[model samples]
Target chain A: MDQILTNALGELLTPMTAAYALAAIGLAMHFGFTGLLNFGQAAYMLVGAYAFAMSTLAGLGLIPAILISFAASIVLSFILGIPTLRLRSDYLAIVTIAAAEIMRFIVSTTGLNDVTGGPQGLSGFARDFYAINPFPAGEYGFWAWTMDEKGLWVRVVAWSLVIIAALFVAKMIRSPWGRVIKGIREDEDAVRSLGKNVYSYKMQSLIIGGMLGTLAGIVFVLPRAVQPGNFGTGLTFFIWTILLLGGAATVLGPIIGSMIFWVLLSLTDGLLSAGVDSGVITFITQNQIGGIRFMLVGLGLMLLVIFRPQGIFGNKKELYFNG
Target chain B: MANEIAKGKAEPGCAKVDPILVADNVVRQFGGLTAVDVKHVEIPRGQITALIGPNGAGKTTFFNLLTGFDKPNSGNWVFNGKELAGVPSFKVARLGMVRTFQLTKALSLLTVMENMRLGYQNQKGENPLAAMFRSVWKKQEQVITETANELLVRFKLDAKKDDFAASLSGGQRKLLEMARALMTKPTMIMLDEPMAGVNPALTQSLLDHIKDLKKEGMTVLFVEHDMHMVRHISDWVIVMAEGKIVAEGPPKEVMKNPAVIDAYLGAHHDSDLGSKKKAGK
Candidate 1:
């Protein structure tokens, strides 16, 4: 019981939670603020992770690897945006989803097995990052809530990135450019008539959001092995759920949403697994707990959609998902 | 150039003053149907010129063509002596011509003041790098805000400056659209039905605002069906029927012309005089 409680509480501060929060904030910029339907956010993460890992493996330093990753995300955004930005929002969504799938497939293919490690994935890229960690080697935390030096370092870096990204995005949305993006979301024709280059704004939005997703991807792989399977369509859907759960347009919504999502997920998993072990819920085996947890979250999301579709942080009047 | 000389002759298609917009052989067709087939037309500078036509006379379509909102099938137009063939709407606006929509396109999600700020040209805050640092565009933003507030006060929208554009009444939206357009400090303002859907109480104020544009040394071109409003404010009137210009002159003279009467009243000669008297009043 103590182990279950500790794990559930600890999940809130994990690097994975921070990564999802960052990615979801990026999605909020794309869908909530700009009215751009970018269904391939996972592709940005994949590209970022692979680019960072590959560059690092090829003898590039940490800063260079991170820069290359951001550049890769920008190139990916251009490829996706150039053809689809001029069309309806749905075209971007379609192209993005397909592009993400293609990227995952490419990384997982046998042709790139030597470099990407195929389905097996890549590791040992975080040694330099871990070497620079200022945290001393020890389990740090009060009472039952403890994290190792590596875990503490990853969490600090990841959460810092999330906070910085959120602040940056908040400032942007309040700026003159942010006004144009929100305007485009409402009506591109009106923005264009006002002498704003709508295509250029949309492209800029795509690239910025993609770059943030890449940053999230870098943090996501820092504490774990880089794997193509981790950045599937399910990952994108999870990010969307986090974004919608908090508040699609609000700065802090994604962070709060991610924390809640992970906590709920772990809590349910722990409870269900314990219930099965105790023979209190004999109908389902322990293996089914993962599926059941997802089902429970889905049900909660449905309730949220029905009751408050604008999300916890978003204003009801500002809810514009039509694009 | 032939049309310039034709102006003094009181010909059907002519401009009596210095022309700002010149359209030649401009045609826009929707499948087999010709929406606008203007052969030649010139709009005078620094005057409130009203483009009046009966329903389905292609007045709005002509406005769309000249403003670069829609392409003409076969036509070339010049604004301020510069050829504007294949220019995009934003570029057209940048080149000193801006337009408002028939159905107000005020961004509903944005605040009234934010909508006004959107009209200011060449905002440094719009640049990605410049946007990150507040100090870079902060002064310009303040200048834009002051300008926006001033316009809002002039348009009587200062009280609702913080309100969402969606929350405004229909007439208020129209006023906001016009005020927002002025933020660009445009040379030519093309309004598409500025009085449409507006309450009668606000109609006179809108008319005064239209007249003010001309007084400010900015050319004003508008499409309106209300003959009374057209005659009350417009210095020049251009009449269109069946996708072609049928008459052009001073409002009082053009309103009484037989071709203009026939196009509007549909061959009813007796009712023409009666409607003309009512329009002239």
Candidate 2:
């Protein structure tokens, strides 16, 4: 039990967890604040990843490449948001999913094999980003858990970016502009009559949320080589699940949700696999572990929704009827 | 009828005021239904005016058109002489004309204080760049909090200051909406069904607050169905039915006018049978 707990704690502290948390935070803004059903958060992530990787591949420096990627994500958000965000809520969900899938297809196409590396993806592109690491090489952790120099660096940068983005979101929600967005979420007609451009505000919210999703993508591939398969619909669903697990419309919700999600996933996987191998449970094979773990997670989510639709720490009042 | 009122001696109380908003032959059509067809309606500056009509009388529709919430098919409306027939809602608010919805549109997710903060104009922290200097905005927030506190106290909503707007009762929500509309510091305040769904106990205070709007030199245009309240606080009354203005004059005269009576009492005679039986008691 102690070993399993230590192993889970080590995984929890990884940079990948931070990146996932950031992406989930962005989704929280889109779905929670604006009541936008964006099911293609992974597409935004793909664009961010591809943009950063491609820019670096094209010989751009680290910081410039990252900034360029962020910009690219914003442009993509507009493109994805324009036709869909103007229409019904379901349209946004449909279009976002299609957009994400389209991005995945484009990134994996043979026509762009030279730059995107087709399905193989880009490697050594994150080296420039990692080059500025201030952390010295040493195992850092207490007890049975420790992360090396590179792992430590990734965690530091990833969590730092997440914190900064989360803080910005919190402040923006407090501002007048934030109020207008929330108003649109509840009733666009009321806000429109107040002389606000409803479409423009929705577009802005989508773009901002998408850009955050993109930031998550960049953070994700920072710890490892960029891979096309990573940015999938399943990834988007996982982010949504994380967002739901934590309270949506909360700054700390996504961060906490992502951590809990990954921890649970790892915990369930470890316990089930250990049980199967040690003969404590004989019905499941090692090959079936992945699917079973997700099923368990899904059941947990179902129960959560049944009892507490506002997530673990969410205010129920925030869960009003979406206009 | 309007011409007759104009020919008569202008009432000494609020008749001599200048007109600040004019709806000239405004028309809104939804397929075969004509919601509002107001013609030659003028809102006197610094006076509380009531727009009374029966259910489906098009009072709200007219309010929507005036505030730029809904576009008129044909007509012209000018606020302070500026043509506002096609302006958007937020821009209208920014132009010193703010309105409240019949069903209070308070952001349910936000705390009452936060909703009040959103109502305030001239907040420099709305810019994405200004987020770093949140301290600067903090002072502005303090002013906003103080102002919100004062307004909340006036409305008797100070106790629920930290609660979510969703947690408020229907009457409290109405008060919050009115308070929010004031945040924009608009010269003209248009309220849609301000008295509807409000408590009878709160009605007098709400009416007094509305009268205070006129005292403070803010033009008020409200659509109401409560005839008693309408006659009491309204400086002038404009009656609408099936889209057109049937009568416009001082409350006493407008209430007695045949057209205005027909629009409310005559048209709803059958529907009022149920209520009249109860009222007879």
Candidate 3:
């Protein structure tokens, strides 16, 4: 039991948590601040991951590969934003979800096997990144928290990016530009009447949020291989859960929210598997634990929304904005 | 009163003596229905002009077209000597013309001060890159804030500047919307039903604000249902019915026009509804 508890707490240092938190911040920019309903954040992550992996595989240096990923993020944002930005917000939600699925299928198809590695996915692209790992080649920390130099590097880089992103977002939200986006969120016509180019502001927000999502995608795959299955619609929804669990509009909400979410998920998975392995649980097999933990999360989400729609860190004053 | 306002005898589609806005053959249709079909209309410069019509008279639709909030099927309008037919609403506003909505859009989630600040344009801090550097826009933001504070006090919304717009009363929202529109310091202001849904206590203050705009030499064109408010504030009145201008003149003359009276009341307006069968035309 003590070991299980330590294992669950250990998830706090995983790069995956930082990745989700970064993407959640991006979603907050889109939905919370700008009132843009982009439901295809996973598509952005996929694009970023693919761009980085493919570019790196083609002998491009790490800087150029990352730049290519950023460029891809902008292209994807425009592809999604142009047609739907003029319409009501709901159209964006529909287009994004569909576009994300389409991208996943494209990357997963056997036709793109040589380029995207098809279902097997690309690997060894992080060689340059790991080669530059400043940590000495040795085990770091103790117990469940212990990891090698590469693991330490990945976590360090990922968390640093997440912290920088959260701070950047918090600062931007208080600026004059933030005012325009927030006004657009409430009423686009009102902002337009004030001589603001609402469409341009919306597009800018889409690009910035997409960039954040792209960075998150890059971080998400740094410690592991980039898989086509990982960027499914479920990924987008999971990131959304993290955002709402933290606070949709607040800066620190996504960071803390992601931490709590991963810890809870890990804790539940640990406890359930322990129960099954020790023969204390009779009904469910080990295979069912993964699905059961998500069910618990769903119930927790429902309860959170019902009891506190403003979220844990969400301001009560901004409650009506959510409604 | 009508002679000074119009070049000749006041009538439907009459020309203003000193026109600020001129539209020729402006028409808009929604599927089978024609919403607005103005042949020629000129809004007088620096005066309070009221656009009055009953429900479904296309007054709001016309306002939408003039403000570039909606597209017209045909016809072109010029504001301040620039062709503004295909211009977007934001560009139209930047050209010194601004409008308010019939339904108040007070940006409820934002503080009243933030809403007011949004009304100002061309802030360097509004640029994303420039926003990262405080030295570029901090002083300007402070100036904008002070100006917003003064506007809030003038509108009697100083006490509520820190409060979210959602917390305001309906009448206060209306005031906030108007005050926010003024952040642009527009030369021409179009108000769509500014008095609608407002409390009677605030109505007088709203009226004084409109009158104050005229005193500052700003052009005001407003759509309204209240005849008393129109008569009390407007210098020129243009009446519409069934998507066509029916009368144009001073308030007293326009109010007395049989066409205007018939548009507001029925054609057989003299007949009483209580004794409708006996008084049938």
Candidate 4:
């Protein structure tokens, strides 16, 4: 029981939690701020991860590889936005999910095995990134919370990026450009009548959000190998859960939401596993734990939708999911 | 046509004064139905010209075409002598023409002050890159806030500056919409049913604001159904029926025309004329 508590608490500082928080913040910008239903956000992460891996594998430096990945995300945003932004919100949702699936298939195809490593994925790209880490080589933690040098470095970088990105987004939403995008979310015709190029604004919003997702992708792969299967539709769903668990529009919602999500997930997994091992319950096997945990999260989400549709921090009046 | 007889013009096309807006042979159709089919119409510069029609007469549709909110099926139009065919609505607004919708389009979630601030054009803070830095547009934002506050005061919505626009009353929304439109400092203002849903007590104030647009050297074109308000404020009136301009003249002259009365009251034109005459006097 003590180990379970420690493990759940430690999960909060992991790079995966920070990555999900970053991606959720980007998703908030798309759905909450701009009212865009971009269901292919996982595709952006795939592109970013693959682009970074391929560039670094081809002997590019860290800065060039990161820049290349960001550029690829922008290109992907334009490709997705041009055909769908002019249509209704449902079309974007449909196209994005399809595009993300297509991207996953393309990266895992046998033909791209040399570059993407097919299902096995690419590794050894993070060595260059970790080489510049300022943290000294040693275990660092207080009591049950602990991490090695590499783990500490990745967490430090990932969480720092998340904080900076959150601050940037919080400020952006308060500016005139932010107001215009919010107005576009409300009614594009009203914004257009005010002499704002609505299409351009939507495209800009798509690119900015996509780039944030790309950065999240980089952070996600820093502590692990670049696995193509990781950027599946499930990833997008997880980000969505995190976004809604907090407030979709508020800055701190995604961060706090991500932490809570991981903590709950880990807590459930630890409790169920412990219950099975100790023979306290025998109705379900160990194999069913993962599914049951997800079921609990889904139930929580359903309850949130019924009672607090605006999430924890969101204002009820600002809740406009229909764009 | 009887419309030509009232105006005493062989051809009812261009205004006698310099025109700010000119549309020729503009037509819009919805499936088999023709929505708007204006042969020719010119709105005079620096004057409040009222576009009046019975229900389903395409006055709002015409306003939509002229303001670039909707495209015409055929023909072209010009604003300030510049051809505006195929121009987008925002571009048209940037070119000094702006419009308000029949159902008020106040961003309900935004505060009244934020809605007003959105009307100002060409703010450096509106640029995505520049917006991240407050220093880039802080002073301009301050200036815009001052201007927005002043407009709110003038429109008697100053007390509700921090309140969400959704909380405003119907008449207050109309006032806010009009006030927001003025934030653009438009050269030409087109209002669609500015009096609709407004209380009778606020109608006179709305009319005065329309007149004040002309006084400020801004050309105003508005669609209105209230004949009394039309005659009281409009310098020129154009009447449409069945997607065609049937009459054009000063309000009193247009009201006296048989073509205008027939289109509005159908076969009971005589009784409507008597009431109109009494109201006009």
Candidate closest to the true structure, highest DockQ: 3
TM-scores, all models, native as reference: 0.94, 0.89, 0.97, 0.94
User: Which has the higher TM-score value, candidate number 1 or candidate number 2?
Assistant: 1
After superposition, the stretches of candidate 4 with alpha carbons farther than 4 Å from their true spots are: A316-323, B1-11, B267-281
True contacts kept of each: 0.73, 0.44, 0.82, 0.77
Could you tell which candidate, 2 or 4, scores higher by lDDT?
4
| CAPRI class assigned to model 1 | medium
Residues B210-258, model 2: lDDT tens digits: 9888888898988888889988998788777777777778888877787
> How would the docking of model 3 be graded?
medium
Q: Tell me the lDDT of model 4 at A57.
A: 84
Candidate 2 DockQ vs. native: 0.33
**What lDDT score is found at residue A207 in candidate 1?**
91
Clashes by residue pair, model 3: none
TM-score quality measure for candidate 2: 0.89
Stretches > 4 Å off in candidate 2: A1-3, A84-90, A135-144, A174-201, A316-323, B1-17, B265-281
DockQ of 3: 0.73
Tens digits of lDDT, candidate 1, A226-256: 9889999999999999999999888899999
Q: Rank the candidates by DockQ, best first.
A: 3, 4, 1, 2
lDDT of 1 by residue, B48-94 (tens): 88999999999999999898888988999999999997998889998
Ranking by lDDT: 3, 1, 4, 2
- Screening candidate 1 with a backbone cut-off below 3 angstroms (N, C-alpha, C), the clashing residue pairs are none
